[model samples]
Target: MKKLHLACLFLGTLILAAACKRDTDFNYYYYEPADFALLSQYLNLPDRPENYQSTLPKHLQSLGLAARPVDYDKATLGRVLFYDKNLSKDGTISCASCHKQELAFSDDKKVSAGVFGLTGDRNSIALGSVLSFSAYYGTDLFGPSGVPFFWDNRANTAAEQNLASMTNPNEMGMSHTDIVNAVQTQPYYEPLFRMAFGSNQVTQARVSEAIAEFVNGIGSYKSKFDSEAEKTLGYNTYSNLERNNFSGFSAAENRGKLIYLDNCASCHSPLQGRPEKMKANNGLDAATVDAGVGGVTNQANDMAQFKVPTLRNIELTGPYMHDGRFATLEEVVEHYSTGIQNHPNLSPELKYGYQPKKLNFSAQDKSDLVAFLKTLTDQELRTDKRYANPFK
Candidate 1:
């Protein structure tokens, strides 16, 4: 009887070892020792998110905002999901397909291409073109405190926005069940889901939440403007003061700063990098080709009103506007300087006596404005490994 018991224990140990070996073999094909090490760090325990108070310039820190607590493991899982083409119906498109990192997470095309080569109705909005995503959307949950998302302000949160993108027939073309099945079928995602959620179970809600957390981590603050602004945080009082030229700027750039402050700063705040109004009709068309916010709200007054985007990384994100009408900075400047049409629902700031007001900028003014706009580009964000595709 003692010998029989000992034999049974030995057999059980052998089976357990075999199962562990098989699991290791499955992952070894894709993950190297180094890759597993990276994965383990992200999985076993998550590092704290970057400290905004230390990372951000004091000028931005003064905005009375704090970073919301996010699970780093979940965000890492979200990063993989963001770049995974398997999320799409045909396995060709990913979140990264339309929103490229080099272009400040925006697309060069007027409208992004979707699954089956179908075109989207609107341009891909730049995700990281703010000091932090929290600053633009606010730390509040779905409520009056934060701005709604998309050009039309239709979605309330990043999760909602991602869900819309995934289900859109022309976009990812995945239903909730399809998305879950796709994620479950991927062997790589097994450990990712396990690490992120403490189990290898994939759910639609988990997928959306993880992607949302990853996107919320996206931010661009290390620009030429930030470098210059950091030096003056002690006394310059950037938002309230009569803006002065930065010591680091060239004469043309300084001139451009003045033009931006005097003419453009009312809409696009210089220091804060947030627009005064969340949505406005920028006089893109004399008549509303797309009803814009009105289409979402079913309100007459909201017609043609679109979300005013932050100008961070404006240098890289081009073929600008919701429709991608303007191709160059010069053309964009010229539009604001002279091309604003007398639309019925044009913002009050753009109207003078109920007509679109032209700035009458000279060639030099336009050139300088473009120069100043270039300063807003955050070079670090263009190639940050944290935001890059993890699938290799």
Candidate 2:
């Protein structure tokens, strides 16, 4: 009886030890309550400054362009919405799926995959420096300076753009009603919605607005180029020599800057006063299938026109162009140097009389051009925790 009692005690001790080990393993795999509390702070944000301007360097601001004020709560709400896969029909995709923060908020894929493994038609355009969109495109500020959104410029505002993506069958595949229901069902969204709109009610318009505020808050100006540009006189006052010999740039990069100014600046000027007409047919083909802006306007003259994206983070946001045809900067340089075709509505900037003019850049010039483009990369924007995924 004593031996039997001792045996029972030993078995009980082993069982208790095993239970404790299992509990420890479970705890190790899951996030702690403290970790969740810290993450929740991102979702339930504090009030933002009413007149919050972007963190972009002062020297980079265009003369007449004013920074739009940001509401912190709204933008924080946007950040959550941007990353939430629950917004999709199957809970498989989010805005971050295409516009990844690591790639300057652009996709590495030539075309991004949407919900259910469907691929988008065009390469995703990078969302870096989107804060400048309203200032550059708003009709009240810069008359006819920019179009709505997308490669074709179909949507009028960032909110409209977000809605288009969310509803598109190939993208998020959720309707207005469905989006409201989906968001409402998620427990985490109630707090976010309340913070953003002062109520926990989820509406389609409010969703888009929150997402747009978040997108519009993203800015990139801490690049090597901005650093160098700031050290010189203001963008408007810089002399040709000062502009070319920007501080910290190597001789090759400086030479390439001159080449860019001479050849590429009319359409893609680094300084302010962007072209009034934002879209251009960059002589991609003599005849093309994609009607671009013409598809929206149904104007024959607008055929083949596409929106001109800012060159702020061009180095990381490639393969270049609307269709993502050119995989490398060298390929892009080659296209401009020799591959320009004669399209009837080609921009005057790319034309010498009736023929599409070739840049005829030498091999060395092409290499230097690629080197200079790399200087535009903003390292801080790539790793900034504020824009990072808040969800564990």
Candidate 3:
């Protein structure tokens, strides 16, 4: 009986190993598109009706960050729409044109160019950290305390934001009718729409919702910082040994982490919704030409205030700030350290009354901060086949 049981166990292990290998092999081949009809098989697609939760880092989970469940069919439809240049009126550019997957869904350009070489006034915010953003949305980062979307706080929701960009003259250059007409002309959208919505018909709302679903699915939780922080008592309460002997961080990086917690965490807290909810006037200018949040509210107090973006993947998403004024993290650190201007509406966190307060970080401190920031980059996100271009 013992011998028979051992033989059965060995066979079960072999079967499991073979199944894992087959799944791995399938993923490698599934990405190679031969025809549109293959999409019907749902190869390489996430399983349906299974609530797909974003894989948040342990630290975030400890902080009570939670992601909404995503429907695989909806997200798949969104993937198709995200890569389809046909969504644009001229059929030359897609949403992927500005939000490239390689760069953490942010353009490397200071200001991204739109359809027909037209340019926007502000830098494109990275959409890759969608899990964090989604979890914190409708909290302080978006409502009651924070302005909703864009550098200027122009749109309220991701759906509204997408529609705005799609219709903007400088962006995809399409009207509502244009978008519907464009999608209607594409035969591929019929099957995708059917799969997502249980119907072949496409609507403007459906298009926006599908794209937003895809954007929400983009998330990063596999960074070096995430791995190290998971082993410790989160980012705020690292013990000496945990700080000094973190798996992949250097001494300088560890020191920088302490500095960030002390000086930056009020606005960029890893656990709280503070990072997304708070907007600050980092004293960019004494009197700013661009109003930022003030532009949307037309309030003097809100002037020069922009949403504080998440620091995750901050290394890849540059040039930094609303206008992409600073080209490097060094420059950004320097600005906070010594270059803060005394703007009337400058965030109190960065000022004493009306006077801008300098952090007075040394040169080495700046380098260390930049080093630590780079640790936030998620290598897996850069190459994740789930978020890659699917139109090929």
| Candidate that would win on lDDT | 1
Model 3's C-alpha root-mean-square deviation from the true structure amounts to 9.1
Q: On residues 1-392, what C-alpha lDDT tens digit does candidate 3 reach at each position?
A: 99999999999999998778553344333222443345544334433322335867666676666665677667777877888888887888789888888889999989988888898788988876444545655333335543367876667777788899898889889999988888888766776787779887889999998887777677777888878877765644434433354666898898888777667777876433337345788888889778998988899899888987778788888899889999988889999999999988887788866679999999888888888888888888888887777654
| Span of ten consecutive residues with least summed lDDT in model 3 | 27-36
Model 2 scores a TM of 0.84
lDDT of 3: 0.75
lDDT of 1 by residue, 141-226 (tens): 62564667888999888888998999999999999999999998876677667767888889999999899888878878888888
Residue pairs of candidate 2 with colliding backbone atoms: none
N/CA/C clash count, model 3: 3
- What are the Cα lDDT values of the candidates? 0.80, 0.76, 0.75
lDDT of 2 by residue, 1-392 (tens): 99999999999999998778553334431223553454455443323322224754555563455556767767777888899898998899999999888788998888888988898888898887343544554444344555468888887778889999999988899999989998888766776666668888889999999888877777777788777876774645445543558768998899888787788777876553234357899988899668999999999989999987667777788877888888888898898999999988999988999999899999989988888878878887788676777676
- Model 1 scores worst on lDDT over the 10 consecutive residues at 45-54
Query: Using Cα atoms with residue i matched to residue i, what is each candidate's TM-score against the true structure?
Result: 0.85, 0.84, 0.83
| Rank order (by lDDT, best first) | 1, 2, 3
Total backbone collisions for each predicted model: 0, 0, 3
Off by over 4 Å in 2: 1-53, 129-134, 137-143, 238-242, 272-276
Q: Record all residue pairs in model 1 with backbone atoms less than 3 Å apart, i.e. clashing.
A: none
